[model samples]
Target: MRWIAILPVLALAACAAPEAPGSERVPAARAIERPFDVSTNVDFILVDKSDRTLTLFRKGTPVRAYRGVAFGDAPTGHKRFQGDERTPEGRYRIEYGNPQSAFHLSLKISYPNAEDRAYAAKHGLSPGGDIFIHGQPNGSPEGQKIASHWTDGCIALSDAEIEELWQTVPDGTPIEIRP
Candidate 1:
């Protein structure tokens, strides 16, 4: 009789427990492994800085949306010079994929396009390159706590998210990062 009386208290305690950051509360049995088909035709990618959402689109239709994206440590304004620590807001393409990136997985963004270079040259500043959309920081624990913004000047997603992206996104896909 006492055990039965305490069951409700234990259940309440479990309900009150805080969920991990960046995790969605869903039943394990009902969780879908791959929310969207990677092989589906994804035409473009959009990153809205204000919303911190990276959405994949196919023919102007949203296919998948990944939330909880983090930007650079100093995530205000456009990156104009080297070591700005700010994500550049511009139109870019997935130039390549780095299977050997220090980050878990990475897809290179074609920064410093002709316009970017011209703008930087006009200002006599170096438009730092090597921008990417990648996974977590190197050597981070699988369950490492992620903050809203923590990167040099790149777009960041969870390791699992990047892995899925790596498989889904292909080279030359257009990405528009909007402030």
Candidate 2:
């Protein structure tokens, strides 16, 4: 009888817990709109290594700028392997999007291109992949506001950011991750 009271507490925790491995995580119940709409093709992409900013543009002016967490350790070049936490510095594309992503939502950034793969192979290593601009792990949207660097080998954004980017960004958009 004493343990029966604890069941409700456990049930609430379960509902608030992060998504489990191989589990599908979706956006929040209240859907939000995007700040700006970006087209699929871009004239060019710019990344300021000094500042942790991912900017999108059509021609010369900035259409949108997102505050992002770059590689924890000075994002210099392509990630050689796992645990590096280095956001690749290169020209890539948003190959796809995931509505059922573990991080709530994501815009896939194409990392480990042919040259990247070849470089990793030449050095006898695995060019880290699955690097994306995604939302926080689990439902910890608030936790991300306090994070200073990377841990999941991908660029992380606040939950609100993920939703904003998800709506504004289109598939096949060019992305440039800089150091």
Candidate 3:
């Protein structure tokens, strides 16, 4: 009879089981507006490495700017080779969306364009790829402390911020990264 009585408690406990492996864990929810209501369209994205600001523009006007973005751990100069721990500089595009990214959600950056490839070839190095604007990694407390640089070679935004970016920005959007 005691075992039977414990069944209900076990069932309730299952509701709080640990997150599964490969789960896309996002931070707390925030109030974000719909894309259409926010603006007609996104014209371009500008990332200033010196200021660590990612701004969205529409028709040459600044629509929104996400501040306190984290960068690669070794963000000193242009990324030359794979594992450089530096964000690449130049023009790129949001190539795709990853709904199951390790970092909550991510917008893929089309790094290693022709120029990047050529430059790498000249130096006999591999231009690292898989760059993205991503949210904080799942199960990481570091998400809350994003003022400091802490990426492998990608732009890191808070979970709430990335959610807004994911909904507002579209693929093929041109992004200019500068030093």
Candidate 4:
């Protein structure tokens, strides 16, 4: 009887215990205070896959640049079809923002615009979609670094960087993904 009464106290203590080192818990979202104004919207986004860079531009002037961005495993040429494992190369748009993403926050990219669909249809293949500029996978350890290109067909940035980009880049922003 006494042991049964102690169970609730032990459970509470366990709940209050500090997380283990290198825990895979998703970090809580914190307000990012940057030197630049977060409200300043970026007019364009340029992704250079060969150089592994993502640059944000306002009025045709570069405002911010993120280097060492990750891409799909293949990481070369335009995405041709579903399961190509290649990031698309061409102009697209930031269609929407996803606050509840499997990989932290994400900004959806508008892929398969007419031409892409026609190409895939010509070959009788599916033009896979759901590409985004996103952060690390959900529940990834804080500050974990990606050593190689590892996305399916999307661009990836650091969590903090994605948070900043999410705030500065609005929907309908033109994005050019270059080979």
Best model per TM-score: 4
By TM-score, is 1 or 4 better? 4
Error of 2 at 171 (Å): 1.2
Each model's lDDT = 0.81, 0.65, 0.79, 0.85
Candidate 4 per-residue C-alpha lDDT over 89-124 given as tens digits, one digit per residue, 9 for 90 to 100: 988999999999999799999998899999999999
| Residue 10, model 4: Cα distance from true site in angstroms | 80
Q: Which is better, 1 or 4, measured by lDDT?
A: 4
| Candidate 1: pairs in clash | none
- Choose 1 or 3, whichever is better by TM-score: 1
State the lDDT at 107 in candidate 2: 76
Name the 10 consecutive residues with the lowest summed lDDT in model 1.
Answer: 22-31
What is the C-alpha RMSD, rounded to one decimal, of candidate 4?
17.7
Q: Judging by lDDT, tell me the better candidate of 3 and 4.
A: 4
TM-score, candidate number 4: 0.80
Candidate 3's residue-wise lDDT over 50-88, tens digit each? 777787767665667776778999987888889999999
Q: What lDDT score goes with residue 39 in model 1?
A: 72
Error of 1 at 20 (Å): 39
Clashing pairs in 4: none
